[model samples]
Target: MRVPHIYQASSIALNTPVSLNDDAAGHIGRVLRMKVGEHVSIFNGEGGEYFSEIIEVTKKSVVVMPLRFDEHNVESELNIHLGQCVSRGDKMDFTIQKSVELGINEITPIFSQRCGVKLSGDRLEKKHQQWQKIAISAAEQSGRNYVPVVHPPVDLKQWLEQHTDEIKLTLHPRAEHSIKTITVPSAGVRFLVGPEGGFTDEEMAQTKQQEFVDIRLGPRVLRTETAALTVLSALQLQFGDLAN
Candidate 1:
């Protein structure tokens, strides 16, 4: 059987017993029904993983002793930060999950003029936490030791104004440039995926002003969720780990 990979919020050290947090504990003890002496892999999002064996399991916690450490790195060489305009319902959740699996390093939920979601205050904070959890889960499932970050939601303008040396891109149907035509970036990549209704003309103007090059993916327009995944896969194939 494949050793279960669990993410713990606590620091881990070799030969020391580590108690998993409640969420992970529940997964190993209650959900997986794992017994003592069973092996599990644990990562704290600090890079690499600990090969541990369960020493204790209780209703409330699971304690494991680290036997060895692997400096495994599955992150893409092409660093990508995705600025995705919030889509409604489970669309947003699905995008966040699949984006992490596609090797996106950072994701920021963006509030554009056409974005229909209106979360704020505690509700917004809760959603942000949920999205982060999705990212972590994706990392574990995809065998990625380093978890990607799901940053707090920000306004489109706020995200656009942040200075970045990376290549900036935004989708535009009428644009002359395609992803194939843009010069390969030496550093990272920052791209925007607009909402289901697409970005307003004013928002498009702002992106251009911020030096976001408009690029066309293909002839047919894709849905908001499809667009995000397509961009990630295309970029990965062109410049990231999938290039191999």
Candidate 2:
């Protein structure tokens, strides 16, 4: 049987007993119904995982004893930072989840002119937390050692000004360049994807002015969510760790 993996925030050491937090405890005790002495893996989003076994289980808590540490990493060689305009409802959640599985190193949720979701104050914080959890779960399932970082949402212009990746591209239907035409960079790549309605002409001009190459996937027009996933998969197949 496949051993389960759980994400924890504390440092893991051999023979050390660690208590699972409320959420993790619930998952192990209630959801998975893991029993004492069962083997499991624990990671802290720090590029390594610990072999552990359940030591204590109760209604309120689950404790595990670490056995050994393993250097675990499934990250892509070509680091991809996705600047995605937040889509509405479950669309945004699905995008964030898949991006983590595809080995994206960083994700910045962008608020474009055409973005449908709007948040402020506590609502923004809640959304950020929710998306971050999705990223963590994705990492665990995909066997990735490190968890992808989901940045707080930012406006499109602000994100463009702050980002400094070696290679940057924005998806546009009428762009002159194709993904095949651009040369791969040595450092990393950042891809900008618009929301459902897509970027306006002015927004496209601004992105181009900031040195983001406009590229098209093909003749067909893809939805915002579709475009991001397609480009990520293509990049992974072409020049990322997925090709290994």
Candidate 3:
């Protein structure tokens, strides 16, 4: 059977006994009901994994002894920074989760004019924390050694102004340019995706002034969440790590 993988924040070394965190302990002991001597893989988001065997399981704690270490470097060659307009409800969460799985390097949630979600003060802070946790968990599940950074939401125009040097491109169904038209830069790509209603003319103009080229996926209209994932998948297949 494939051993279950769990993420731990503690440093791991061979022969060292480590106690699983409460959350992980419950998962192993109650959820999976793993028995003593069963193998489990643990990673700390440090680019390596520890192979361990369960030593003890109690109501409050689960301990394991590390037997070996396996170093894995599966990071993408292309660095993709997604400037995504936050979607409503669980769509945003799903986008963040799938983005990590698809190998996006960084994500910056944006508050565009057309964006439906709104947050302020503590609510904004709470949302950021929740999104960050999602990114971390997704990274763990996807076998990514590096955790993608989730930046706080910024207004679209401000974000464009701040990241002037990034190769910015915004998705627009009516745009003349296609993915094939753009030259793949050796450095990386920073893609902007609009919200449900898409970007306004003013927003599009601002992005254009910031030198962000307008591109289209095809003739059909894609939702805000779908647009980001589609671009990410295409980049990974065409110029990034997926093809490799």
Candidate 4:
């Protein structure tokens, strides 16, 4: 059987006994019902991972000793930073999960004019926490040693104004360029996805002012969630690990 991969927030070193965090402990002891002497892999999102053996298990705790360390890295060579318009319901959650699995390095929740969901104060903080957890979970399941960072929600203007050497891009139905036609992003790529109703004309103009290249996936218009994933896949195939 495959040894389960767990995300432990604390540092891990060889021969050191490390206590799994509450979340991981619960999952291993309760969810998976794993017992002492079982083997598991643990990563701290700092880079690399540890091959560990469960040394103790209790009703509320789980401890492991690091047997070896593997400096495995599955991140894409072409760095990707996604600026995704926050979609309603589980759409945002789904996008966050799949994007991490696809090797995206960072994600920022964007609020556009057409964005229908409204969140602020405590609700916004909680939502951000939830999204970060989803990213971590996705990393664990996808065998990624580094967990992607999910930034707090930001307005369209705030996100657009940030300076980056990364090639900035946004999608449009009538864009003249596709992924294959655009110049390779030497530094990295920072792409934006619109909301359900899509970006307003004013918003598109704002992106243009910021020098974001407009690119289209195909002739047919895609839903916000679909567009984000589709563009990511195309990018990976074009310049990232998928091409290897």
Candidate 5:
């Protein structure tokens, strides 16, 4: 049977007892119904994972003893920086979750000209926290040692101003080339996708000024969420560990 892998923020050492936080404890006890003495893996989202066994089960906490540490190397060699235009409702959440599983190194929610959701201040903070949690869950489920970060939303123009990547491309329905046509970068790659209504003319101009090459998946025009997921998967298959 596959043991559960949980993400914890604290550092852990071998044979040392560690307590799960309220949320993680509830997940192990109430949700998964993991009892005392059950084996589980705990990771700090840094590098390796700990081989742990549940020692004490309580209402508010679950204590575990880490037995050993194993180095992990499941991340893709291709470092993809996803500039995703925030979509409405759970679409954005779905996109971030799947992207993490597909090996995206960084995700930045871009507020483009046609984005439906507008967030600021406290609302933005809440959304950022929620998205980060989703990415963490995906990393655990996908056997990733490192969790990809979900950056706070920024304007498309602002993102372009400071952007630097080995290869930069923006999705365009009318573009003449697919990912296969572009030369692979030496280190990392960057991708940009638009919202439901697509990027406005002015925003496209800005992307062009930043040297974001226009690329197409095919003749079909994909939705904001679909476009991001599809492009990321393609990159993984071509240059990431998925090719093996």
Candidate 6:
């Protein structure tokens, strides 16, 4: 069986015992039914993993002794920050999950002109926190040492103004530019994906004025969530850390 890799927020050090919080404890001790002395890998999402073994497993907590520390760097050479337009219901959640698994470095939920989701105040905070959890879970599952950050929702224009990445692009179905034809950026990319209804003409024009390259995924129109992951995969395969 594959040893479980769990995400713990606590700091891990060599030859130290770390106590897991209740949620991780429940999953490891009850769901997985792992007993004391079983080996498991734990990471704090701080660029390394602690190879540990369960020393004590209880209903409330699981204590593990770190046997070794390994610096497993799984980050992509390409730093990608996805400005994903906010969508309704589970679609937005699914987008954040898949994006993290596909190796996005950071994400911002963009509330664009065509985005129909209206979130504010506490409700918006809750949604952002939930998306953050999704990113953490994906990092743990995908064997990533560092967790990608999911920033709170912001207006597309505001995010555009704050875009400081070396390579900036936006997805538009009717764009003349194809990603396959562009040169690979040496530093990082800040890409945008539109919502269900896509971006408005004014938004497109503004992005173009900002010098954001408009790129097309293909002829077939993909869903709002599908476009982000597809572009991430393509970038990773072409210029990032996917050597295989």
Which run of 10 residues does model 1 get worst, by summed lDDT?
A: 180-189
Give residue 81's error in model 3 in angstroms: 1.0
Relative to the unseen true structure, what is the C-alpha lDDT of residue 90 in candidate 3, on a scale of 0 to 100?
Answer: 98
Please, what are the lDDT tens digits per residue for candidate 5 over residues 1-244? 8988899889889999999877689899989999988999999888999989999998888999999899977888888899999999999999999999889999999998789999999999999999999998999899888999898889888888864756889999999888889887776888899999998899888888899899999989899888988998888888777878
Put down candidate 4 lDDT per residue, 1-244, tens digits, no spaces: 9888999998788999999999899999999999989999999988888999999999989999999999988888998999999999999999999999999999999999989999999999999999999999999999998899999999999999999999999988889988888876578899999999999999999999999999989899999889999989999998999887
**Each candidate: RMSD to true structure?**
0.9, 1.1, 1.8, 0.8, 1.1, 1.4
Looking at model 1, the pairs that clash are: none
Alpha-carbon local distance difference test for all models: 0.93, 0.89, 0.89, 0.94, 0.89, 0.88
lDDT of 1 by residue, 99-199 (tens): 99999999999998888999999999999999999998898889898888999999999999999989999987778899998775777899999999999
**Model 2 lDDT, full chain set:** 0.89
Per-residue lDDT of 22 in model 4: 94
- What 10-residue stretch in candidate 6 is worst by lDDT? 179-188
Positional deviation of residue 79's Cα in model 1 after best superposition, in angstroms: 0.2
The sequence of per-residue lDDT tens digits that candidate 6 reaches over residues 1-244 is 9888888998888888899977678889999999998998898877789889999987778999999988888888888899999999899889888888889999999898889999999999998999998898888888888889898788988988884846889998888999888776666888999989988889999898888999998998999888999999999888888845
Q: Number of clashes in model 5?
A: 0
User: Which residue runs of candidate 5 sit more than 4 Å off their true CA positions?
Assistant: none
- State the RMSD for candidate 2: 1.1
Per-candidate TM-score against the hidden true structure: 0.98, 0.97, 0.92, 0.98, 0.97, 0.95
**Model 3, runs deviating above 4 Å:** none
Error of model 6, residue 239, in angstroms: 0.7
Lowest lDDT 10-residue stretch of candidate 2: 159-168
